[model samples]
Target: MSAAIWLGRFLFALVWGALLANLVWPFPGKGFALFLILLFVLLAIHLLQLLMFASAYRHFVQWRRGDYWQIVVFGIVGWFAILNAQPQREQELKR
Candidate 1:
């Protein structure tokens, strides 16, 4: 993948991490139970973001017939590739 795509993925992870941390880290020492709950919620949000990215890549691969590994290894860039995978006008007219 291109460096720009890799950078985009980094930005995606960074933004999500920052947002989740901002929401969860401000209440330190409230209680052990609350801390554990917040930790679980943060982990869940991270997982959800990953799953959403993977689903988008998978959907695009089906239509574009591109390499699956590109999506699996580079993650969000795969989805971006799909987003920018517009067929040429000549190609579109054939279908």
Candidate 2:
């Protein structure tokens, strides 16, 4: 198991835990409509995340390795690992 997979699990667990906590403990003075609005906002944000991940996958394919499914399942963490693994190129000196 790679660090990327572990990190991915941790992030997924963290997000889901937060969501669970919010449901269990409602905000003071906030109504159902606010919750619904927040749900939509969160969904939109998740969609954006997916799009950004997909774009990164396409752009970094040359440098990337391992299972692509890991990228899909692990989300940000997997992508972070792939990006991190890329070697830094030295700049050529101008003559």
lDDT of each: 0.56, 0.57
For every model shown, what is its TM-score relative to the native structure?
0.34, 0.39
- TM-score, cand. 2: 0.39
Report the C-alpha displacement of residue 55, candidate 1, in angstroms.
12
Best by lDDT, which number? 2
For residues 29-89, write the lDDT of model 2, one tens digit per residue.
7654576565566556656666677676665544334535445445566566555544431
What's the C-alpha lDDT at position 33 in model 2? 53
- Report the Cα lDDT for residue 17, model 1: 61
Q: What is the lDDT of candidate 2?
A: 0.57
